[model samples]
Target: MSELVAAEDVLLFVNAAVTATGQREFRSSAEEQRFSLGFLHEYVRVNYRPVYAAALALDVNHHNAALIVEGLLRTAGEAGGAEEKRAEGRLIAARLAMLPPQRVYRLFRALRAAGVNNRRTRAIVRGWLAARPDPALDAVKYRTGVKAAVRHVHGRPADPETGDFLFAPGRRVRYGNALLDAYRRAHYEQSAVYELPFTVAEGFAAKHGVPRAVFLERIAPRMTRLERLRTERASGAGAELAVMPLTRLALYVLALPFGERVGRRAELTGALRASARRAAGPYAGSWGRVTAVLDDSFSSSGSAVKRRRPLAVALGCHFLLEALAAPGAYTALWTSGGDDPLMVRPYGPTPLGTRILDALETEPERLVIVSDGWDNAPPGLAGEVLRVWRSRLDPGRGTSVVHLNPVYDADGFDVRRLAASVPTAGMRDAEDLAALVEIAQFAEGRTGFTELRAYLDRRVEHFLTEAGA
Candidate 1:
């Protein structure tokens, strides 16, 4: 991968992991675990300084953040240069001081394990502890133990008095104030904070009295990309924002509210085509004819948080694949009813099997389907259609069918497949779209865990080299 591509992937992974809120459960399936472990290991190992900063800046889960700090401290201790070692120690200490008391306690053991026995390191920890002592946290630790305190912090149960801690002396006070101010502005000024299922942050912009442009410039940087995109669209300010890079632009346009998209459809379509053309320049003639079956069903709009939906993900992939395919060789089949597939919106029910059968008529060399895999259409027709297409349509059966799912079905599966012979993969985000071709190989059983690890190692090396570390 190019340095730019590697950097983008790294940013995407960090954003996805760090900005995940408590309400969101990190997937622990074998595949997800492997991916997470590999990515975290490589990230910390390659770019310890910035990764540690991100963990603190994003205020990720205490345990995950502690792990990054531990890794950085360990690397710092092993460093041969005295200046670099001291600099790393100071950096870690500065970040640690800003974290909550509970998070600091969680890092205690890990710090010890990382050989934080030096005087400078120990003093930093002690100074931070003394400056921001939490009596409640101390009492909890005294009564139940360190583990219990850690659990309490992570659980984040409603503590009416805990609101005072927002202004209490601590490194988090500034961040806490910013959060409180934002919420206050969002609630009182805008009257927008509602308990809705599919609401986005932009839904509150009007009530908060903050223009969409200002929100994007001032507040959106602190948010995850998913949150920012959804909010921008919900505020009906998507078009007013500056044009994004190809992948992000595709997702942004895809997430725009239907009402807001009325007259600007043609302009947005042109932007997508332009983005695709630019993205396709690197590997001009490397791709063959491609057909994509996109599922924009009602379920694609479901979310754990009232944020962006999978529909945006599916649409981004559709445009990305279209751009990457050979000229006049790409076809998009929107499962949602429409005269023009590109103009179809996400709604109605999923018809996976029917769409594949329809796409087979075109006899494209490659097929990519984006969906949540909750096919509610009558009988599961995807498998039967795949069998038919292989048996009758192509004697060589060279057509590659890839099923990409955005949501992780916690029922013990990552990808839901239509046929055993076909490949199914997970499309975690827009960055992963760049690896669509490689992921398809995983579905076909051509790649395994070894290859995945090697890929991660290569990325790590590239990132580190790019950083001149």
Candidate 2:
């Protein structure tokens, strides 16, 4: 393959790995997404193993990162060499540490189901379990997965009663651990249920015939941040937006009634801006003359599974870019011609092309388009506008244009791009916009694999340092 083709192949997998999570999208089924993603994983691992390993260090979502970890461990013997396997091993450990506890346990279940019983796999499982702050809680909270994982790896629980609770539930009359004792007592006592995590508490609450509202209120202290957000939304309590992620905050904003959004515009926008600043961190006020053409069209409503996800991503990117831009140098153009970002609902057809033209007239130094790239409000106008702007209007390429697509096109096996002239990257969250934009820039004529590798190397060092593994 040619150099450009090789680079393009890697970029294709990067985009797919970044965005496809085996979930339904605005135009694709979940099955198709899984099939396409699985195929890409195998193809990239076999053809570009190094890049595949390096991707774990990139801003890939936890879903794909876990998939990568499993794939590497499952096919351990196929690695290029000892050095490669060592590199992949470190990346796996670092990425595993970054994944949520539930996801890591789910991965263990998957490994057990797949019958991957290599010594290395056992070591990884043992190390992760050894690092747990409290294994007894895991046995109580995530009983099935933990039991299977421990048995599959032949692990011995630190607590003797915990063993009885998992392999032989009710075998022991009483337990020493408070959480385990609560689990045993919760079978009969509604008061004991409030001591457990919200999810585990729910089952006990149902068994004890406790009212949902009363249970939520009583278990408020034990609820996680996200659980509190959900319960508080229904209970008319103010959500703790100060601690929520930017994308999730946008989803919450979109879920609110229009009049409520209008009534609380200042509070909502302030929270978003504050969260965006945190995500931007040192990159704040870095991009100059930034313009974003955000798509909130009907298609951006996403799917039944991912309700208003694309719109949420766009909303997230808006505030993120605002924080990343030089003060007063950023402007947002909504495809639906909506000026109020707070009130942008999923309506009207995608007029991406019109938005592109309008953004271009503003003479921005950097143009970022957050769209699915259907661009059919006058089909192909966006591509033509880009073509003329790249070739005729500004042959020297004064303004940099990049498309950040949220949805993956399973039919194409990649994110649908607006034009060949402008580089495109798939983005899972607005928090990773800086990294994704840097990757997209490499796909343009400016840089290639060597630079990409250097970027990945830098990321790998930082990731491992942060992971301390």
Candidate 3:
């Protein structure tokens, strides 16, 4: 519906038809590819081609005047419509043909070596080289080198080693593997998680037994770390010591070829689907009042009773750094970082969050729930605990909560009404470190850790005796 896509919609359709027509004809490979390029230029417009072309042409630098053509092409042996696939082959050739002879020779040689050498493909490369005023051999070389690096040497220059073809074994495997490594370095996983927070949340849920919402809340504190270095650089953070995103780490690890690695995606996916099922329906979030109502109906003593404690779960940012910083402390129940099969809900809440909560409620006396709101747990577990406590606890039951910043209460809470008023001095006196130290000593003497510890000890004894401990 947006202007950009809407404007190009019909063009893509027309281009597809032309591409089909070009494939059916038996013109030389070069001519077929040129026809395809012309059709595509008309279809997507010359402007769009240069977006990618300009990227290539910048060092061959003529900003707007550079006439470049671009389009996708099938590599040597990929499955596709015969005509369509043939046209794609020609398209690559046309793009290449526009380059200078040396560049054309190099590109053509590389492609041929990779086994993509149809006449149309060679001509396409030649034509593109022709349109450019300057020959960008370095650019061509660099691109080729990258292709070679991935073993997609489909168009890469030959290596001096065994004289064996590099990427010829598997084009998809070669290109895909290269793309995976490149994308990983560029840190693309962050974008993937942002695009699929719910999915990631589910992963956490199943792995950690935490509900999605609670997991999100626990991860809230760390969200600021997600600030992009690119944005910071623009704002003058400087190029040095720039922080790349954690999402990239997550994405790279997730995208690894699973066939060779984890091989257990189907099972993980089923667990995620099952977790999703339980949290569905109208009573989905009603666990709050459900606990309170159960508590009230079951016990009149308002004291020690066998009951389940609410689950508290936290989910942190991309787990890489955190895992590295404190590996043994964490119970990594599962990891999808390497060649493991891709989990359908790889980005979801830690499933253990809920499991932990279930355990807490089943044995309230055995565990004490303590967590920093900023720490990560599986999703939705924290909120579950809060809900249960608020609804079911005795009026006298109290909890000490910490708020990181005052901004948390800014949303029309009328904080002043609930807080005790404190007076500000009309005049300020500068108190150096020594004065502050003296004041602290006075305050400590009056009421400090010593008194507080005694009070806590007395309370602990009372509570223990009442419970027959």
- TM-scores, each model vs. reference: 0.54, 0.97, 0.18
- List candidate 2 stretches off by more than 4 Å: none
| Model 2 C-alpha lDDT per residue in residues 88-118, reported as the tens digit of each score | 8888877887889899999999999899989
Worst 10 residues of 3 by lDDT: 422-431
Worst 10 residues of 2 by lDDT: 233-242
- Which residue pairs come into collision in candidate 1? 190-207, 190-208, 202-231
**Model 1: how large is the Cα RMSD against the reference?**
11.9
- Which candidate number has the best TM-score? 2
Better of 1 and 3 by TM-score: 1
Which sections of candidate 1 miss by over 4 Å? 1-242, 245-259, 277-281, 304-308, 341-343, 388-395, 446-453
- The reply for model 3, stretches above 4 Å from the true place, is 1-86, 89-110, 132-134, 137-469
* Model 2 backbone overlap count: 0
Q: What TM-score quantifies how close candidate 1 is to the native fold?
A: 0.54
lDDT of 1 by residue, 177-292 (tens): 33333443444554323311122345676555666566555454345445555576545444422245554665566556675466677777777666656555676435688888
